[model samples]
Target: MAHRHDDLAGHDPDADWSLPGWLYTDPEFFEVECARIIRPSWQIVCHESDVAAPGAWRTLAYLGENIVVLRGEDGVVRAFHNVCRHRAMRLVDGDSGCARKLVCPYHAWAYELDGRLTGVPMRRDYPALALEDNGLVPVEVEIWRGFVFVRLEDDGGPSVARMMAPYDHEIAPYRFEDMRRLSDVRCRERQVNWKNVGDNYSDNLHIPVAHDGLTRLFGKSYAIEAAGWVDRMSGQLVDRASDDPWERFYQRHLPPVPHLPAENQRLWLYYKLWPNMAFDIYADQIDFMQWLPLSPTTCLLREMTFALPDERREMKLVRYANWRINRTVNAEDTWLIERVQQGMASSSYAAGPIGRSEVCLRSFAAKVRDRIPEARLHRAPPPGWSRRVRAI
Candidate 1:
């Protein structure tokens, strides 16, 4: 049977159609998504504090590309391929650390923090090699509100600043630049496509039924709006007691966060930067999460929370409450999304209609389709088909 991909061409932004089932289950389509939609896009890796000091480095494997974010002696942050030029051995084995220079573990080839090939075991062994050209491949790096973002390919799309301009004034209240890391990075792998997680994140209709903790906190008052490529969700925190005892106690005794303006005192603001990253801002702290596709049917979820340096007892209680409620919400979401993945793989499944409340999800799918037309396929394209496409 023919697929619905024909509808992707010049589709209306408000159309109710969802992406086809094959996009989530096909391995070939997944790779196309990585190259077309993810690789060329700016992806948030970690906060600037991750590589705050000279010589500090953070490494990540993203869509088959191994990347290292490092701070050089000049106090500038740079990103590079994690492979050594010679023999292509991985230069770093750990997730993060500090070192004067990066040394290849296999052949002892070394490079400066800025990615210059400064040492090769025996200096005179390679007379034909050009040291400058042999340095690690550089990736585009940008820092916005203390979040470090790296683009694997130079697609010349909008810079991080341009992408975030609409929300700059709104986010200034958080003083993200001054905020320090408040929790160790938490990473969990899930048996679902990354897009499945993104679909759940942009869907507000499931909040009441899927996320009980969030429903208790927001009282069905959450509102989501999309501007340019940024989607913002704001919910007014309720003052009433909750059905759960701890949740009730949390609402009644929520500690004061004076750093946030009085109007923002009881508001939870969530911002989704298209394709992969999401920032969640609450009264006392801000956290960001990213979904990395490990395979066609698996993804890695990474999250980190940040806050102003506050050591008061009341603030500590508030942080603890936030953590407790957040865990409950995440668990609920995980359960729902995992089932959605299973459903996508079913033979009876078909593209469904988007709801009025799912405009953000529609917009996300639109952006993906606009960039990679192959993603609109309702069934997997034939083998070696992507190589024949004129454009992704």
Candidate 2:
């Protein structure tokens, strides 16, 4: 019997590169995503280093729900719903800080670092209420390689280890344990949809035309290949052929570090998880971007962290240079996505064909439609499910 992947050989290369128009503009679809995708999937809350010491805490917004991540006196980090049990007042107001106890600003209902209700402003008023039962609701929190992830679903879908199993080997070399957060920049209230941002970053087929600065620095013939679950794109500097100049420059002013790749000097890897997270790894630093949907057309593209402690000064300088390169590239892509959104809103527009190079994007859309079966109610399962079930 032929394997499932073998069947992909006959898949049409001219197939449409578009998703349903309603996916980007429908309010009901966004609500369904919040329930099925955002809430159930593992989410990055903050880095473990951010809440290292006892009482250190950070507040984050998840699917419109306020969440607080805190390190207890025992040095264990945990996540809790930020709302107070009594009157639902927010316990922690600011971004992050060390606090001995989380005291509600409204009613002074205090909670311990472990999320236990330790004090009430007026215990005499509500004698019938049980403090033990009314403690802050705890969310599942896990720390993997210094990054903290939280899951809000009651079922506890998958462990962080399993969710990130795809890129474990690629990330091992980064030494995430030794890294520290250097900067964070958030783009809020953006008019583009969240999927638009994700679809922009998922593939680099347009990089040569979209990012002229980058294309000029690292030649336009950059190669893109997929390995396991991650996709890599790389390009080499044409001018840096001989090692004599680089060695001389390194000897004079820079510390020892490997020179760029011979064929592809600058290797820029962009990895996208199944749902909505992206990891953009450059030579010196890594960018963790999470695209969160606030509404159908408005979303938050948060730059959660830029971390690199190995070559702080050099990385900082190069980071800004790459940031400028990325800004230009993102602007071009976002413009196209916004245009697509507008076209989607138009009554005349319909689905269009995806190019041969856009297989990844097509695969991504298929996977999305597969996982959220409700989205593809018309299609039957592709052979594997029934065969595997019968084999079992």
Candidate with best TM-score: 1
Candidate 1 lDDT by residue in tens digits, 224-336: 76666777788888887888766776677767776667878888898888678899998778988999989999999988889888888877787788888888888888989
Summarize candidate 2's per-residue lDDT along 1-392 as a digit string, tens digits: 00011112235332354566656776766776777677877777778888889999987786879889999999899999999998898888868889999999998889999999989877888978888998899998888888888888845456666656766776666667766777754655668778777777756666666766556555654655433333444554444332333322322332223433432224556666646777776655677878888898878877755555555565555566566556667678778878866766765644555655665566556655544544433222343443354487
TM-score of 1: 0.93
Over 4 Å off, model 2 = 1-17, 154-157, 220-265, 310-315, 377-392
Candidate of highest lDDT: 1
Worst 10 residues of 1 by lDDT: 1-10
Local error of candidate 2 at residue 229 (angstroms): 6.4
Screening candidate 1 with a backbone cut-off below 3 angstroms (N, C-alpha, C), the clashing residue pairs are: none
Steric collisions counted per model: 0, 4
